[model samples]
Target: MKKPSLTILGCHSSIPTDKFYPTAQILEMKGDSFLIDCGEGTQVQLRKAKIKFNKIAHIFISHLHGDHFFGLIGLLSTFHLLGREKSVNIYAPKGLKEIIDTHFKWSYTRLKYCIDHIELSSKKLEKIMENEKIEVYTIPLKHRIYTNGFLFKEKPSNRKLNMKEIKKIPDIKIVDYKNLKLGKDFMTKKGKIIPNYQLTFDPPKILSYAFCSDTSYHSPIIEHIKSVDLLYHESTFLKEEKNRAINTGHSTANEAACIAKKAKVKKLLLGHFSNRFPNIKAFEKEAKEIFFNVEASEPLKTYYLDY
Candidate 1:
C-alpha cells in the first residue's frame, strides 16, 4: 500500500524557543509536496531537513497569525533569488494578498516566478484543489479569526492483473489482459468465457490525512475528518490548563484527544505546544487516556501514514 508522510518543521506556539520554533510542516504524498504554515525560521528548518526547495508547489496558511505565516515573504524572496521560474500557488485567507503586495511594492522586489493566490472564504467547507493523484479540501475551523484546516485524500489506484492467471491461458491476447484488469470478462475465439475476478485483484484502499490547526474544542469538525488515516490536531496546553486554553481560543491535550477519538482516526499527532509547559510528555499522557495512538510531534522527524 502507498502511504503519505509528514515532516515537522516547527511545532511551538506563539514564539520560538531554544528547542522549538513556531508552526510549520511538510505533507508529502504520491510524489507531491505541500508546505503548511510557514512560520518564522521555517526556511532554515526546511534547509536543515534537506528538503528540495523547488518541490513545494503549494502552500496552505491556517490563519493570519504571525506565528502561522511570518516567514512567507522571506521564503518567497528566497525562491525569487534562486531564480525559480515555475509558478507557486498559495491557498490562504483573504488579507494575505494585500499584505504581500504592500511588502513587495515597498521593497522594490519583482519575483521571477508567478504567485497564484487562492483566497479562502469563511462560508463553508469546499474543494480547493484536485489533480490526478490527490484531492484537497478546506476544513472550516473555529478560531479567533477566519481559520481553515486542510484534508488531503489520495485517489484510488488501479487494479493489478494476475500474471500467473494470464500465463495459464495461452489463447488470451495482450489486449484481453487490459480488459480483465478493468473488470471485464473475456470471450475466447472459440466462444469460451473467462471471468474477470479470476484474472485481477481488488485495488488497495485509499489513504487520507487531515490537518486541524489552531482551533478550540470543536465537535462539529469531527464529521468532516472522520476515518482519516492520520490527523494532526493542535494541543496547545495540558489538561490542568483547560481554562487558559479556552480563554485563548486554543485546545488542551484532553480536548484534542476527544476529537481524535470521536472522529475514529487511525493515528493522532499532537503539536503547537505552549511554551510554559516544559514537560511535553504530560500532554501525551493526558491525551492517551482518551486516544491510544497519540504522539507528540518533534522537529526534523518524519511520521508515516498508512493503512
Candidate 2:
C-alpha cells in the first residue's frame, strides 16, 4: 500500500517573495490528491514540485483570505484552458462560490468541466467528506474571518491473507479467501473451525493528518486532532511577538507547540511565517522548547506519514 504524504507547495504568510510563497499544500492519500489552501503562485509551485494538476480533484480552502486563496481563479482558468473534462470539487467557506462566479462572469470564461462548491459554515468539528479508503473532517478554527482546518484520516483496511498459513491447511481454498480477509473464521468440510487470526494478518495501521490554518491559539482543536500522525499548524511569529500574533489572529511558535503537546500528535510542522523572521529556524527552536517532535515547514518539501 502507498503511504500517505504531504507536500508543502507554499509556506509563507501574507505575501509571496523570491524564497517563500503563501499557504498551500498537497496531501496525497488513498491514491487521491487534496489541495489545501491555494495561495498566490500555488500553480507555479505545484509545477515546480512536479505535481500533476489533473490529480488534484478536491480542494480544501481554509478561508477567504487573499493569501490563502488568491490563486484559485487562475488555477480554475488553467483547468479550462487545458481542456480538462473531469469535475473538480472545492470545499471552502460560503463566499468562495460567488467570488469564482463573479470572476468568470466578468472574464467571459466558461469551464468545460463541472466545479462543485461544497460550502462550509459549521462552527464545530464535523465530517465533510468521505470515500471508501479515507474520511475528512472539519476542525473549526478562529481567524480574522471564518476559517476551518481539515483532518484527513485513512479508513481501517481489510485484513491481509496469511498465504503461508493458508497453504498449510488443505481446507482453506480460494473461495474462502474473502471471508478470511473479512476477519471470519474458516469452516472445514468436517465442521472444524479455524480462527480468523490464524488465517489472516491484522490490517495495517490507520494514518491521519491535520492541517491547522491561520488561527490564533485555540485549544479546542486539540480534541479534533488528538494523536494524529502529522499536524501542520500555522506559526506566524515567535513568542516574543505574542501580542502581535494575537492582534493579527495568528499563533506563535510556542503556542503551536503547546497545542501539539496537548494533542499528543506524533509530529508537528510549523509554517505561515511572518516576513520579519529571516531565519526560519527560530520557529523550530521555540517550538522544540515545548514539543520535541516539531519542525519548521519547508516549501516544496514532502513529509510522509508512515509507521
Estimate the Cα RMSD of every predicted model relative to the unseen true structure: 1.5, 0.8
- Candidate that would win on lDDT: 2
Candidate 2 lDDT over 1-307, as tens digits, reads 5789999999999978999899999999989999999999999999999999999999999999999999999999999999999999999999999999999999998899999999999999989999999999999998999999999999998999989899989987788898888899988889999899997999999999999989999999999999999999999999999999999899999999999999999999999999999899999999999999998999999999986
Q: What is the alpha-carbon lDDT for the whole of candidate 2?
A: 0.95
Clashes of 1: 0
C-alpha lDDT (0 to 100) for residue 44 of candidate 2? 93
Error of 1 at 276 (Å): 0.6
Question: Residue 301 of model 1: what lDDT?
Answer: 91
lDDT of each: 0.91, 0.95
Off by over 4 Å in 1: none
